[model samples]
Target: MTATAEPRVLKHQALRAQLETLLDGMSVGDPFPAERELAERYNVSRETVRQALRAVLLEGRIERRGRTTVVAQSKVVQPLMIGSYTEAALADGRSASRILVGLTQHTADAELAAALRIAPGAPIAQLERVLTTDGYRVGLETTRLPADRYPGMLDNFDHTSSLYAAIMARGIDFERTEETIDTTLPDAREAALLTVDARTPMFLLNRISYDQNDIPIEHRRSLYRGDRMTFTTTLRAG
Candidate 1:
């Protein structure tokens, strides 16, 4: 009688689990097994192994050089800011720049909806750009604005120019802003677009800026290169 074949596991998930195990047993900078060898031992496709490895890489937990994956050191914190990126860099003695990607009008997603204080599916103008300092690409920023507040905004300014500066020129003074920061790994697309290897970790910032009338004007989410930038903040007692 012929025996039934053993069930196959989802290779990516299995590989991810194994990576977590290996990481728990090692420290940052410790070398891991070669990717091809790991795939062979696990009896999985190389693509599956890569997918699993990418997830770990994104968390700043691992680094890949040549063909090997190694653990990565922790990322540092940079202070958050609620003002213009240009101002922030100038204050730190770094030159600031923006490289415009594109702009389009779209309805808000769930997350954008809450940030803009608008109903889900409300029309909004989305702008994408790279935030640079001293000619080095430091972060990627995407800003969304409610269309009703700035109709024809896309036609008026170069996105590489300061959106805040241009908006304020139109009589919308940016009164203040709130911000939050966290660490995350970039996806394959984002990694390529940001010109960073997938192994490099990133810092994510979610910020909302308001007008003088206390109306929310701009909502931005930025991803900064983990190794190059530090987010710092000064705390005050209430």
Candidate 2:
């Protein structure tokens, strides 16, 4: 005799499909029907509705608000390139803003020296900023520049403005950037700044931006809240 699918499994699958059908044509922020109503409409138990919603939540298809759920906003699309969240948010029709947290002089460590192509212990200019989209704080960006390459950067670059804008204003042409992406749990301070639970994971991205001569001009590490972004990359066959 063939093994049979359990009744619970079949019911849950049917309920999940029913919920997806109900979600059709809904606006991104539109609230999902209340659990009681969903249970009655779908002829399933409240637990069944919760089970269905769990799958959707994991897929980032919807998000839970206080006492309810809503269709999630589309994930931010990021092509692999030299860019900033400030620019990316605007491209997606969202307002981007920056808050300069700190700016100071620092000495390069072994890792920074290699990425910035500066001698270890050389003086470097460091800047930190928080990036927000429509008031939702999404990323913390920390950047360093070899002080010798961009003298007076502390005074010349407007920390509140776009970092790329300031570098270009100083006549340094930005040619390209290389980046590495990873993920990890937010630190205590990062969790507080991001208003997320301490266990919330974040996207950690490091970049080395180069000038026309292939000289590295900037080295940056940006930590992004995982809930708000979905990085996308495209690959083509050779």
Candidate 3:
């Protein structure tokens, strides 16, 4: 059974390579060839073509649109560094904007308290927004800050603008940040907000930003669509 499976795997891999080559010549949003046509051109069975196409789809080289598949737009590359989403999008030659979702004040729970190093019942200002790049919804972000530390933040801060800029305007600055990244699938509400399938994979980012005195000033949780964005970093050899 193992021997039989190996050849099938190799065949699909080879077919996937050919499909990628085909995609290289196509422009973004160009219609991908039908499976029947691909099978005929490659002299393979339709099932083999289907398997190859599935692999390509998973790689984000192509996407399903209604009843057709088309070449996908290049994923936005976000550097894993201290920067604002607007700054990163501008660097990529894309326009960035945000839709204000909600803004409210709440008392910090035990989990939030530990993360921000504040009292469990301390007043916290929570801001939620949907991030967009080039008019496409790409991420959702929720940011929490100590309400007492940033007085009038809920009323003065513009939810649609860069949060970092607003913080700087208040004479507050980020000295450093600690961030973690993981993968998750969106819930139904999140999927509807991001305009993605509920099964779509997402990049979950949690960050804690600190002041010059190493005090945690901000806690942020963000979710970015895996198909529309990617994270990059530079590593130095020690």
Candidate 4:
């Protein structure tokens, strides 16, 4: 390789190290060194700086929020692999705790029916809870499970624990899943539960979980603290 190639590789590696340092220290909204500053610090061209930052962006470590690429706190590196929520949280050293807000058995609505792939009038178990970190309210989740899957699911587990974990204990394969995430403003109930002011930007996560037979097992909507949590997905260059 030419001398130019070696420096290019070194600069990329250095940038990766710097980005990891930022992730380990800062929260979302924290600004990074200016592009010009990065070029100076790394002894590389501005183009190199841009390329390095693009790597971080692809990894969901940083985002273009405003005039700057801001660091994301708790960049949620969700693998394409299917795993339990509690497993992911504990593996990342995040405080995973829940408070039961409401529990009921009800007929599915239009939206729930569509997501759960069930009839509108089908019976479902509605589980609502608040998820917290370090004793601070961080998010809220409301899950709908078909009543036929678990005869008495609403009465089975304590709401403070992970429902997926509890469900697996019953020999149900709560193993496979799919998720879609978007940002949205919080409603009155969601705002109060998350302890954020109404209209605060939230990470709206819509998840669909399936069993081994590809049967929809869990349909859920969760609202996360936009400032404190960041969702990440890995992508490949096309």
TM-score of each: 0.64, 0.75, 0.86, 0.63
After best superposition, candidate 1 residue 81: deviation in angstroms? 2.5
**Per TM-score, what order, best first?**
3, 2, 1, 4
Each candidate's lDDT (Cα)? Answer: 0.79, 0.78, 0.88, 0.74
Candidate 2 error regions (>4 Å): 1-58, 62-71
Give the per-residue lDDT of model 4 (tens digit) for 145-183: 988878876675777777877777777785567888788
Which scores higher on lDDT, 1 or 2? 1
Q: Is candidate 1 or candidate 3 better by lDDT?
A: 3
Which portions of model 4 miss their true places by more than 4 Å?
1-81, 236-238
Error of 1 at 175 (Å): 2.8
Q: For candidate 1, lDDT tens digit of each residue in 134-202?
A: 665668899889988887777868766778877887899877888877889989977866777876778
Q: Residue 136 of model 3: what lDDT? A: 77
- The count of backbone overlaps in candidate 2 is 0
RMSD of 4: 8.5
RMSD of each: 9.9, 4.4, 3.6, 8.5
| Local accuracy of candidate 2 as per-residue lDDT tens digits, 104-147 | 89999998898788799999988988877777677888988898
> lDDT order of candidates, best first?
3, 1, 2, 4
What is the lDDT, from 0 to 100, of the residue 163 in candidate 1?
82
- Candidate 2 similarity to native, TM-score: 0.75
On the 0 to 100 scale, the lDDT of residue 111 in model 2 is: 86
